[model samples]
Structure formats: C-alpha cells, structure tokens
Target: MANQRGLATPLGVEFAPPHRADRIAALLAEQDRWSPADMPAIHTDTHLGSAAPLLDHLRALKNLSPKAAALRDRLLAWDRRMDAQSTDAAAYAAVRGAVVRRLAAHPAFAALAAPPSCPEVLLPWLALLPRIAFALEHLLLAEELYEIDRSAVVAAALEEVAVLAPAAPWGQSHRLAPWRALATTSDDEPGLAGDHDCVPCTSSVPGLTDLSARGPAARYVWDLARREDSRWVVPFGASGVPGSPHHRDQLPLWVRGDLVQVVTDFEQLTKESDV
Candidate 1:
C-alpha cells in the first residue's frame, strides 16, 4: 500500500503502517530462495529500491511467531514465483496466481474487483502507481528481458499503464509541472525553463520505452534518519483534483529533482479528510 491518503488530501490511498514493510521483505527473500541462480537483467536505475525492505526482515524471520513467519514465507514464495516475467512464462503465471490469492483475499480488494481510477475516490484503493512503487524491482530489474530487449521492456511497461488507465480520470495531466507549497493555484500553464522535462528524459528510464518512464501519478522518498532529510513530491502537486488551480503544482519540483521536506508538525498543515 502507498501513503497516498493523509490529512492534506482525500484523492490518495492510505498506506499500511510501517510494519507492513516486512511483508514485502519476507516475500522477496523467499523469492530469491526459490528462483534460478542467474541474476535477472534490469532495465533502469529507477527500480533499485524494490527489494530493499526485504533486507530488514531477513533477521526478523529467524525469530518470529508462527503467524508472522508463515505470512512472511508465503510472501517470499510469491516473489520467487513472479521473479521471471520476460524470459520465463511459467514463473510469471505462478506469481500472478499468488497475487490473486494474496491481494484479492483482502476485504478491500474483494469489495472492488477493480480498484478505483484515483486514490481519492476510494479509500484504501488498490491502484497502479502504489503497486509499482513497491514492485518496481520486479518489473524493471528482476526480469531478464528488461535488459536484453528494449521492445520487451516497452511492452511490459505499457501493460501496466493500461491496467490503471481506464480508472484514471485526466491521467494525461501527469506532464511536467511546478509545485507551490504556499502560492496561489492557477490554471494557466507555467513556463518551462531550467526545469528538467520529465516528459521523456527524466521520466523515461534511458534504454527503456517512454511509456515505461511514465509512472503512476506520484512518487516520494522519506529518509527516517533525519526529519529534515526526508523529502517528498508528487507528479502533480499538493492537490489531486484535476483542473483545480492547485492541481499540478508540484510538477517543477519533481522535474527538477527538488523535494520539499515533510512537515511533521501537525499544527502547520491542511486537514481535508474527504475530497
């Protein structure tokens, strides 16, 4: 799950508590245990963080309750099943099935056979970008085809976008834009200067398809070691509603690779629970 939902906006999905990071970690470790010894080829630098959480859980797995261990192992097994997407067709199916069994079993996924197009419209919404944010390694790195053939990477990337495009409203608005934390919102197009054009170069991972670079609506990085070191930004801006003046305010920061520090003080914030 992504930390899409918060006090500031209603158009994003709420993230699972920090404890949930272990689930992904356990699954990845299990995946490595079962997968072939050959390292799968990777397509881009953008996906390095995919399996990072698993490192934290490996030690924890040794001393865990039965329930915790089982969950972790199952997730690991699932990762192994999906590790081979491009060259290994059999492995892909296994992983997909595991996802259906695991993710679909959740009440939230069950209620919506199809996740909402936007996170704001559906609480705990299971959408594309959030899923990609966690599984980027698998999609871009773990699979061998990611590096061998550029065509394969492009096709795979398009498949992901197609999955969520239907549900996404005005999703095309993800073009590069600037973010204003305290400035007034406006509908006029902002000038693009010195701003990295996320359209192709920055957004698209080199050697991969342009579509592959187009990520789900937003991205963020939180460095827990230091509160000030933690920085965040979205493809659009502080607001999620499209056509609103506040919409797409953060485009410039994202394109420029500039991130705003997370404001921990609750008093200095906007609390809008619902869109």
Candidate 2:
C-alpha cells in the first residue's frame, strides 16, 4: 500500500503531510490560535469550526415573513432535538422536514436548480455544499421551487456527497486529490463539474457560506498614481533560480485568500533564509 501523504499550496509553500493531523496542526500553529470570532476578526481568526455565516445568511434572506420565521425557528428546534436523539435517523427526519418547509416557501430558492459560482474565500467549505443540497431536497420540498434544472442540482449534489458519504466513501478523493507539485497524480476527479451548482447564490443548497462566492484570497485594488504603488511576486519566481525562488510562488495563498507578502530581499528576509 502506498503511503497517503497529502500535499497542497494552502500558503506560499507546498504542504505535503504524512497524515491529516500534521496538516491541521501546521495550519493551526501558523495562525497561533483557534476558534470562531466576529466578522472583522474572522478574517484573522485562525480557526472557523462552524458553518454559522452560511446559516445566518440563509436565515436572513429567507425569513421574509412570519411563515419564514416559523420555519427557521422550527429548523433550529429540530437541530437541538437531534443532539439528544438515540436514533439519528428519526432526528434527521424531523430536521429534514423543517429545512424542506423553509426552502419550498421561499421565492429566492427558485434559483437552486442551476450551477452557482465558486466564492473565493469559501472554497474550502466546498465539501459541505452537497450535504446542504441533500438537506434541501429531503427536508425541504425542493421540487416546489419549480426549477427547470432540478435534476442538474441533484446530480451535482450527489457527486459531492460521494466524497464524504458514509458508504464506500471516496478514499481516493480524500487520499489522492488536490494535487501538489511534490505529490503523485490522483486518479479521482473532483465531484464538482462546470455544469453543477457551485455558488451559494444559485446553488440549490440552503445555508451556504458567502465565502463560496467572493473567495478567501486577498485582492488589492491598487491605485496607479502612487510611485511605490505596484505589485510583487512570491518565493521570488519560477526556476528556483538563485535570487528568485519562483515567481508567482504564492499562488496557493492567493487562492486561499491569504496575502502576506513573501520577503525576497536579504535585508527583509528572515535570518535563517538569509543565512
């Protein structure tokens, strides 16, 4: 059996780990602390454990009337009930009903049958997008939304579910996917396809995080008038040339919405790297 060492460019450098815990620990350590914080702080906050932003956004947008409020409340109530259930199935069913009612009655939900955009910051949350869809269809009468592309959404959601679903889970998906320059190529394909719903705005799944749309990358709107105003490269540059490690080396950080500058100059670089 091949060792399942995973690699990714989550930050500027290639992150290949012998185990998931190693990667998680590296991430947590880099940030220094963990736990969800309010919005402004959320950007700097090292760890975000819950899908609160998605739920809050959905509740805000869908709760247009007293009926919507009642539905939302019921959904919350069911969540609490699920915590105490001896049989998860019964709890899931009740929770599912509330989600369905809330989704079916909302006008905005009409758009779920089509593919949605992948938000920048919320890309990591992509894994959960399908589960959200499953809840929508099973709990909420998703068909009542009357989408011409209903089946399209279901198919896309199922693809995502295949990655983490209990039965015959995508060991390859988890083990070999998300390639890195240092790692071996993966045979497994990502569950998401161009035709599938990929964004919170158009996705059939409710309670999606807004990050799915904007992305987590730092985007600078630089004003050209300033003299010092300009852009720079990361890890120096490609070729791993003596002076420049590699141009556009920070691609992963950019993808993940992290934008700390890579120090290239001897005066600015860390002591160890300079030495």
Candidate 3:
C-alpha cells in the first residue's frame, strides 16, 4: 500500500510532458519562455557531466538569496562590490580544488589517475546544487559517471540521506545491495532519452543513492473491454516470504518492464482448499 501514495489520477494519464516543441517554441520567443522547449518531442542534451552544453547557458533569476552575513561579506571583501554573475562552466576554476581532493580519497576515483580537475563544470542555481554537496560531487565526478562499468557505485551513493522501511526490505536493504544493470537515464536527462522504445529506465537524482530512489512503483495496463486481459507489474514480486520461489520471482520481469496478466478467471488463479 505504501506504493499507492501521492497525486495519482484515476483516469488515463500521459506519462511524458505534454508540451509540443512548436507550442513551447512560441512561448520561448519572449524569454526562451519554456526553457525545456526542445524536450519531450526530443530529450534535452542534459546529462550528468561537466562537459554538457547546457551548463554554458547564460541566464539568471535570483541565483543566490540566503547566506550568512559574514560569508557574503567575505565574497565582497577586499573592496569588491559586485558578483561577476558568469553562469558559464569555466568561470569557477579557482575553487574546484577542495572538491577534487575529497573525491580523490575514493578508491575507485584514485585508481583512474584522473586529472585534478574537470574544467567544464559550472555554477548553477538549483536548490540541490548549493544545499547538497553530492550534486557538486556528481559534477566533479562527471567523467566517471559516464563510464559503462559502475560496479563499485552499486552500494556507494553517499551516506547523507536516510532510507526507511520494513526490515530487510528493498529500500532499507538496497544500500548493501548489488546492481545487475545500469540505465543511462539520469536527473537532467529523461530515461527514454536516446531510444524511446527502450524498456529499461534507471533514472536517479543527484546527491542521492541510485538504488530505490524514484521511478514508477507500479505499471498497469487495464483492458477496458476484457477485464482479465489487463496486466500489471511491481518493482518486487508476489511472495513476501524471503526464500520462496514466488518471492522476487517477478523481479527480472519488472526490471525488463514486463507485466503479468491479471488473474481474473477464478479457475485460473490458485485456489486454497486443502493444500
């Protein structure tokens, strides 16, 4: 029942953002009014990397608001008066060292012999950017995040956030869990970015663990004319018992975006009598 939470609708809903490129293009004429004008019809160039072109976007709307008086004073110290307000990636080169050192401690990061800096990173105004350090970590680790082999990150998504649930359940136990696959989808990029037909979509928000984060909890295809023809799938399986065959049986199907038909016919479903 926990999965059945939030602003879900009873009627048919379009999963993708509905705005068309042409309509959004018109709105964006004034101020690039619909910033995601190129989206949905086609995914954005956004990705988890310092090299993305989106970071070079030059626009601002109150990028910084709250800060300690002393900190603000320090930024304005030495008779400096105004902030440069350059939104470009390369402008913040001076302060990238601290982040580089922190990531260097990770064994996976150290093994690569990566450069001290990824110069393509930028300053952004997202709420997560300033409040959370992992966003910066992702920005700094963009190079590695793009790689094919992410076996080490299967259990390492940072420890700052809390995971709660029934004991040994996925949300609680996934921290020590292993990863069988890695989907290219990410926060800045839609899951179905390159291949719209692809079934696997492993999107994860930055500054958070990749496992059990956010995605569709369940998928359903209700057949209106024939009720039993309907099909559905959940992230886990049917049996709650840990070692049962039915336990986690549908996990592979769920990961592959497959569904199980509804057992509406009384005779087809298991009937508990004397068993």
Candidate 4:
C-alpha cells in the first residue's frame, strides 16, 4: 500500500498513516490473488469520501437566502466526481476560496496572521490563508464558534462566487503547471480531474491558486506474472534525446493516465549498435 499511496500522492490525496495502513491492509487481505489487471483499480481507488459529512451539513443549513440555497442544492446534487469537466467542482472551489479568504481577514484569527519567526521552510504553515483553507472543515463544523458566524460566511461566499466565478469547467483553471527546465510558448496544459483529497488528487495550494503546481511526475504498474506486461508513463516521453520522435510522445498518454507497455524480448528490439 505504500507504493499505491505514493502513486496516489501525485494525484493529491495522501492518506493519513492510520487510515492508509488499515485500508490497504484490508484491501490486500480481501484479495485471494492479485494481477496486473487489478493494479489500476487498486491504485485509482481514490474517492472524495472525506467531504460527505461536511457536504451534508452544508445541505442541511437552516434558512439560507434564495441564492445561497440554490447554490447549496446544486452542490448537494453534484455527483462529487471532481472530473476535469465538472462545473460543480469549480463552484465548490470558488466558494471554499472565498470563505477562507474571508476568515483569514476576519478579526477572530488576527493573532495568527503574524508571520512565524521560524525558518522559511515552515513559512507555508505560518500563513493565515493556508491555515484557514486547510482547516476549513473544522471551522465550518466546530460546535464552539469563534465569535464568527460560519453559516453567514458560507452564504455570502456562495453568493459572491455565483457572480464572480467564470462559467467554465473545473479543469480550465485547475491544470498541471509543473516547473519546466525551459520556458514554453504557452502555459496551457491539460485539464485535470480530482481534488486535493481525492484518490487521483489534482490539488493546488488552496486559497492561493487553482493551477496545479504538483502532480504525478510519472505513473507505472509492475506486473509480477510477466515483466513484459508491466507498463509506465512519464509526464513527457520515454526518450530524453531532444528532437527525437519519442520526445513528448508519452504526454497525451500521461494526461489520460494511460501507460505504455514495457518491452523486454530481445527479438522485438531494434538494434542501434552491433555488439
């Protein structure tokens, strides 16, 4: 499960140690035998199950204004797939961002706004917005309100997003934005599916940006039965030689989470040198 969790990391969801170990152990124990064909399902089992409780609470909020109620209903109706084309995911993101931003600026959390005196490496933790964004679930559901009306914040956020957010697919804004060795002509990349907490997590820094700065650099499935049946894919391609046909050839496959089969048979090899 460590290996599977590692693969899932690029997608965004890093299962907590306790849950990760138990879940994977349960899955393994349930299987009589495992095959390469079963690897994909095991690896991609990331579902946004974490958000259900919070979503249910949001749906049950009392006396939401008309616009807020409408947005809430839409969210309730969402399939929670977090697919690249999901507009509901985009809407959720917008609302979440707005709420975090508002909370960060609220006087209730003023003391936390001060930058930590610790090292620069720990700066992200000291940032107020990130802190709020990461702990939003707790903030929304906390029994003891911090003198701030959480319900009002959600309603306002929903109304604000309805007017401010562009009508576009979630992937239009949430995409792979990896740091490149060389500057490209365009920043345009493929639309991604999944969320920060999902199995195929495509999470960006919440409250900061929607553009994904981190994701799976590569994907692979090793076949114990037949080594040749193993498959792999990198963000770019197999060949490192620039100007070669193989350069960037695997990109589309990578984008689609597909893999190329490994070839080990010498008979299938194309000899480039006489030995």
Best by lDDT: 4
Poorest stretch of ten by lDDT in candidate 3 = 157-166
Kindly list the per-residue Cα lDDT of model 4 for residues 1-275, writing each as its tens digit.
43345557677664443333444456678879886666555444444554564476577577776777777788888877667778888887777788788888889888888887889767766678877776777677788768897766766777787666456888898888876666543445787776666655555766778887666667688888789889888877767555667767887787666778888898997965343
Candidate 2: segments with Cα more than 4 A from true spot: 1-143, 146-218, 232-244, 255-275
Model 2's C-alpha root-mean-square deviation from the true structure amounts to: 16.5
Best-to-worst ranking by lDDT? 4, 1, 3, 2
Superior by lDDT: candidate 3 or candidate 4: 4
Model 4 weakest lDDT span, ten residues long: 14-23
lDDT of 3 by residue, 1-275 (tens): 22121255454453322222333334346453221212222222212223221112111112332332222222222221111121111112112222233333445544444332434332322323222233443443355544423222211211101121111212221121223343532222111221111122223222223232333456666667778777777655676555557756766565445677778787777753442
Model 3 residue 250 CA deviation (Å) reads 0.8
Between candidates 1 and 2, name the one with more favorable lDDT. Answer: 1
Model 2, position 199: C-alpha lDDT score: 13
Which residue runs of candidate 4 sit more than 4 Å off their true CA positions? 1-46, 115-126, 184-187, 239-247, 266-275
lDDT per model, in order?
0.36, 0.31, 0.32, 0.70
In model 1, the runs with Cα more than 4 Å from the true position are 1-213, 271-274
Question: For all the candidates, what are their Cα RMSDs to the real structure?
Answer: 17.7, 16.5, 19.2, 5.0
TM-score to true structure, per model: 0.27, 0.24, 0.33, 0.77
Candidate 1: tens digits of C-alpha lDDT, residues 49-102: 223333233223354445434444444444221111221212222222233233
TM-score of 4: 0.77
